[model samples]
Target: MNVSRRDEDGPRRVVVGVSGSLGSLAALHRAVAEAGRLGAEVLAVLAWEPPGGEFGYRRSPCPPLLAAVRDAAAGRLATALGEAFGGARPAVPLRSLAVRGQTVPVLVGLAGRPDDLLVVGAGRGLLRRGLRPSVAAGCLRQAGCPVLAVPRPALQHDLDALHRRHFWHLPEEPVPAR
Candidate 1:
């Protein structure tokens, strides 16, 4: 853990990963709340990877296709951020980054600074809770600083609100771990 009183550049900030998932959105809100209390900033990262299999088999991509994919990812990030913040930017600064990579490694990389707090959702689905591991679990294992994995109840509440306002669905919010 970084024992430093303050970061070299400035005050330490909260870093969160958002993927338009209920868990991720909840994590974003939690990060924002932490930042507000700490009087810090927020680094919102939306990491994405291209389609695999046939798409990955080829080394080079057509410029137009790659651009289109990146644009779509950016749009998703924007929408997620808007929804997470209730359509208004918070009082704290929120920097959004859309990168091309696996979610865990990308988020872990951003959490390299000892002062940085890595926040992620518990993720979704039966596989995430059971058969498959969650991205939050991966970041917790490798992140340099503290990791906060927001529980599914908070996530479910957020999803429920969104469902009411935007006609969305909360299909797989897990029960809080006992």
Candidate 2:
């Protein structure tokens, strides 16, 4: 599924993954604020595993409870993001999506394009191993564009402080090549 907003003079597009964790929230907020500053659109994604059996042992249908939980979480995430970034007016277009599949593949597929910026949280959790040779790392290695992995706690605090100060700037130059 694709969500696109056509604005002749708007910010670029960014994709943020929210895994219903504090880290994910931080990433979402950061993405929103950054997108706002850059005049970009936001794509908030939540990927959940559907109810099923291992391999092909016994396939179970997605229970209503699981579906409800996922739906509610998605809604809450959207609302929270909207509230966090929402201001006097809708400065940025934030699109929230709930997908059924593995997190890494879903995220990579969502932000694989060259035009999109993939934003993810970094820590120790399902979505934390983005820097390692896991799904997140794989996406970073294979993604057509750049991948921004924000350290959940520290990065979130820094962003909050920066917002309050109302002074921030991107790095002047890229990090020296390894």
Candidate 3:
């Protein structure tokens, strides 16, 4: 016999992973839209790990520094939320959290309800290691709920291209095709 548990977590949630990147902002917007469409609440989650990973922190733990890092993570989450919504509240109910852990696990664990929806950005930037598609992939494999991977906004792609050109000191105007 199968036992089904009731979700005590009020409304279904559109759980989004936010990292303050343009891609993440795009995901956040998509999540809000989904929440509105589904009459669900929006749960914006930002995950952070201590500098140099857990092993590094364990080797030389500093409580004060750890506190500062955690505080910074919370501040970044607040800033990302404001930037994502342009300081205007979303029409849907919204809740924000900044947790200390691996991103994929944190997201998957929080969005464990069968009705929950997990949203993640699909890319990062040209000059960086970029969005770990693995986050979305991991969620897809592990989440009990549906996963929505939002593609990076076109503007982000353009900005990344411009950044790439600037990094290489290339002329802004491309050479005319022969």
Clashing pairs in 2: 11-39, 11-40, 12-40
* TM-score of model number 2: 0.63
Best-to-worst ranking by lDDT: 3, 1, 2
Per-residue lDDT of candidate 1, residues 13-58 (tens digit): 8999988877788889899999998888899999876666225826
- lDDT for every model? 0.81, 0.70, 0.89
Ranking the candidates on TM-score from highest down gives 3, 1, 2
Scanning candidate 1 in windows of ten residues, the lowest lDDT window is: 52-61
TM-score of each: 0.77, 0.63, 0.86
Worst 10 residues of 3 by lDDT: 124-133
Alpha-carbon runs more than 4 Å astray in model 2: 1-11, 52-58, 62-66, 69-73, 79-90, 125-135, 155-178
Residue 9 lDDT, candidate 3, scale 0-100: 55
Stretches > 4 Å off in candidate 3: 1-7, 125-133, 170-178
